[model samples]
Target: MPRGNPSPKLAITIDPDVHENILAAAAREGMSVSAWMTAAAREALQRRAGLAAVAQWEKQHGRFTTEEMNEARRSVQAQLRTSRTVRRPA
Candidate 1:
């Protein structure tokens, strides 16, 4: 017999409604539940890390002003629009 993949497996418990939602999301994405959950978990961790980094920066500097926050929001929205336009099929 061939050797199996060496990735570690996790056993998790979620509410029934959440479980059903996860199944539907995985099917919609054409991914196995494990793969979908792994992607979701990775995204969450990345977002958490980004927030922590921002907090550290603010500790050294100061809290962002309303105008600065608005500018950042606009910049992110513009980038998202550009990305969507680029992703569209011809």
Candidate 2:
């Protein structure tokens, strides 16, 4: 998808609990429910793709150097910390 382009419409059904949760989350984020769900779904798909790519790379390469592994760990930890900080209070 191109930057700044509008997203295409999608219709999906969720269980009642899930639907309520999505609405609550969207409200917390000050986003329309559709926008919030779209952003979340996009992030999830990207993360899955990233993990699959990393797995493929590891399978082909066998293993990484100690330094390389440490750098990856640090990068993941930084992302975790940032995500935690940005999360809304429950």
Candidate 3:
């Protein structure tokens, strides 16, 4: 599928109960159903994309061991401690 602007007109079918629940939730949030649904769709798409990217990166780099991860965290902490400073009088 091409990645760009979405179709101006699209149709989706949901169970009536589910649709009613969504409408009620949207009303509670003070958003029109269309806006609420659009936001929900976008968030789901972005989360899926993020998970896919992470999976690809892990496949390429391989997963780190617990020891390796702990060492990396320590190294980062040490670096931050060295680099961070209290603000002095301007």
Candidate 4:
């Protein structure tokens, strides 16, 4: 994929099975493998940032209680169910 500005490139090794899966996923999304990997990396970084923020909050405010965590899990599950039921254009 082309961007107006150039970005650094990365080279890494992975298991053959994982490499094949990445190829298939990239094709399914109509993206180049590099673009797919870049997107995946960005998502991972964002998730790490979110986790770090939560940990910092917990450190100041005390960790979440088990009940609070369970409630959050239930809310997320309900949202996932609702989202799956909604239809989108193919």
Could you tell me the TM-score of candidate 3? 0.60
Query: What lDDT would candidate 3 get against the real structure?
Result: 0.83
Clashing pairs in model 3, backbone N/Cα/C closer than 3 A? none
RMSD of each: 3.5, 5.3, 11.1, 3.5
Candidate 2 lDDT tens digits, 27-89:
888888877887898999999999899899989987778999899899989999998888654
Q: State the local distance difference test value for candidate 4.
A: 0.90
lDDT of 3 by residue, 30-56 (tens): 887888888889989998997798689
Candidate 2 lDDT at 62 equals 78
Q: Which candidate's TM-score is highest?
A: 1
Q: 27-79, model 1: which lDDT tens digit per residue?
A: 87688898889889998999999999999999999999999999999999999
- How accurate locally is residue 22 in candidate 3, as Cα lDDT from 0 to 100? 98
Q: In model 3, where is the ten-residue run with the lowest total lDDT?
A: 81-90
* Model 4: how far residue 50 lies from native, Å: 1.1
Candidate 4: worst 10 consecutive residues by lDDT? 81-90
TM-score of each model, paired residue for residue: 0.81, 0.69, 0.60, 0.75
Clashing pairs in 4: none
Best of the candidates, lDDT: 4
lDDT agreement with native, every candidate: 0.89, 0.87, 0.83, 0.90
Q: Which lDDT value does model 1 have at 68?
A: 98
Candidate 4 residue spans exceeding 4 A from truth:
1-4, 79-90
